[model samples]
Target: MRDRPQSDTRERIITAADRLFREIGYQKTTVADIARTLGMSPANVYRFFSSKKAINEAVTARCTAEIRMRLEAVAASGRPAAERMRALLLTAHQSVLELGVTDAKMQEMIAVAMAESWGVIRAHIEEVDAIITRVLRDGVASGEFVPSDPEVTGPCIRAAMMRFCHPGLLTQCHDIPRPTVEQQADFILSALGHHARS
Candidate 1:
């Protein structure tokens, strides 16, 4: 019963941190800011999270979970491989753009994660890759996609999508619209020399 308040406090801290990270970015936000947002003291915030980096990691994990959920939903839909792949790319593209453009805090948090929280970023990438690999394998087994090594194909597809989805890359290449999932799917199919639609 005593643990209940501690659990609530932890959750409140995490929630406040997530919202601030999405709004003001990780680099710009301080522990005091989060504590103020939660109507608590900076010392109280420290009791839950020792450092700003720790809070960033928690926020990143939450965001990555959301991304995985969205991807899983798309994968679970009874769509063809080509359509599913396209949907995945579009969804990822939109997510990145939304994070970078509309959610400045999230973009800053991502930058920090890439620079300081590499382990967290790497783990998230691996999880996302595993999901994509499973989806590709399922598509092949169901005869919706051609035989291809998901181990190789999954990482390659992810890398390509990451390049297009990267905020810095997109900013530099603003004149060019990011490729649709259909275009990326076609490229992958051509590389595999198999009809993803069939």
Candidate 2:
């Protein structure tokens, strides 16, 4: 019989790692723990990933990919740029809030991911910036936004929404009377000249 494909094995490893990370926190989860979950030796898992860090990166990628799918859908929708922008931010903030509120362990995992600057997390941020850039670019083309450099403007939007976008901040602000996503979106829209700025 042929052996399992490498991709299949790798995905299995990532899936198991994600569960363990959610259960035990990234700091406590081990390669051996992941291997045991798969009923394999740590050496076998190593054939697919070099270190525990790699496993964590894969898990992080998986989580962020889910968020990207939603953002991409919002970007591709036919709604007006202003509505799309609002949807994008709301979708992003909601994803993190849903995950954080539903899974308490996820916040711990996010803290570790942030502390280590995981490759997947960095890539996720860049992709998110790209999505924002796409919306801003379209808005400018449609005369809904003031013309500006999307490269510059996208990061600015990300920075302005940092409180709503950052996972750690989202969790901490859960109890506070923070601005709603719509309110933040309106401020961003105003800055984009969606309304007259005095």
Candidate 3:
């Protein structure tokens, strides 16, 4: 029971860190800022996380977990390969929009994650790609899809989806409707040589 409070505090700290990193960005958000956001003292915050970098890592883990959860859901749906791929891409794109990109702080955290937390980011990418690869491979094996190297195709598909999902990239392509999650999924399917289902 005593451990429950500690766990709650830790969760609160992580949540605060995630929000602040998205709002102000990792580079500018201080430990104090997170502490204040949590209505706690800096020292109390330190008890939860030793440094801003640590908090940033926690935030990254949380974000990666969220992504994995969504990907897993699509994979478990037992849909056709094209449908699964579309679901995966659209879900990812919606996540980006829901998370929003207007926060300079969040952008900084992502930038830092790309550079400093490459291992963590790479692991997340691999996890997501693995799901897509499995779907593609399963489709081929079941004679639902053409034979292809999933190892290569998965990453390429992910790259294309990422470009469409990225905040920076989306902003640049603002002319596009930004589409609903379903629409984005259909678009990805179309791009991958699959006809969109009615």
Candidate 4:
């Protein structure tokens, strides 16, 4: 029960920061602004978050949590491995685009978050890779895909789709044409000696 208020205070700070980030670019939003919006002193906000960086990390984590949830859902599904992989890739790409691509303000916020909260971002990527590795391991067990090292292949797969899955890459490649999701999935499945679903 003691933890509840602390949790709520953190949530309130995050909520205020998120609003400020959206209204004003992250570069322009300060800790004081967040505190002011919350009707609290900057010192009070600091009591909850050690610094602006910590607040940024918390906000960034919240943003990426959406994508992680989507990927976890696809990974946990009863669908075939190839199908799940395909869905996971598509879902991840879509989530990145939704969170950072279409909105200019959001893109700026994401770029800052990526730079400021790199450790958090890297951990999120590893979490995502673990989920993919699980699907690949299951695929091998089911004979749906060729026997290969999921631990090795997961990062490779992520690399190949980085342009689609990475927020910065998504924005960078916006005006450029790239392989469709089906095409990429097919290429991966064929490389693994399995037929990709249509």
Best TM-score goes to which candidate? Answer: 4
Q: What is the lDDT of candidate 1?
A: 0.75
lDDT for residue 17 in candidate 1, whole number 0-100:
84
Better of 1 and 4 by lDDT: 4
Encode model 2's per-residue lDDT on 76-127: one tens digit a residue: 9999998899899889888767665336678777776766756677889899
lDDT of 4 by residue, 1-198 (tens): 566988899999998998788789788999999999989999999999998878878988988887899899999999988789888888888887776555677678777778788999999989988988998998889998889888899988888788787767677777876587657767877866786446
In model 3, which range of ten residues has the least summed lDDT?
188-197
lDDT: which candidate is best?
Answer: 2
TM-score of each: 0.83, 0.89, 0.81, 0.91
- lDDT winner between 3 and 4, please give it: 4
How accurate locally, in lDDT, is each candidate? Answer: 0.75, 0.85, 0.76, 0.83
Error of 2 at 2 (Å): 12
RMSD of 2: 2.8
Q: Is candidate 2 or candidate 4 better by lDDT?
A: 2
The whole-model C-alpha lDDT of candidate 3 against the native structure comes to 0.76
Candidate 3 segments whose C-alpha is farther than 4 A from its true place: 1-3, 23-25, 176-198
- Model 4 residue 28 CA deviation in Å: 0.9
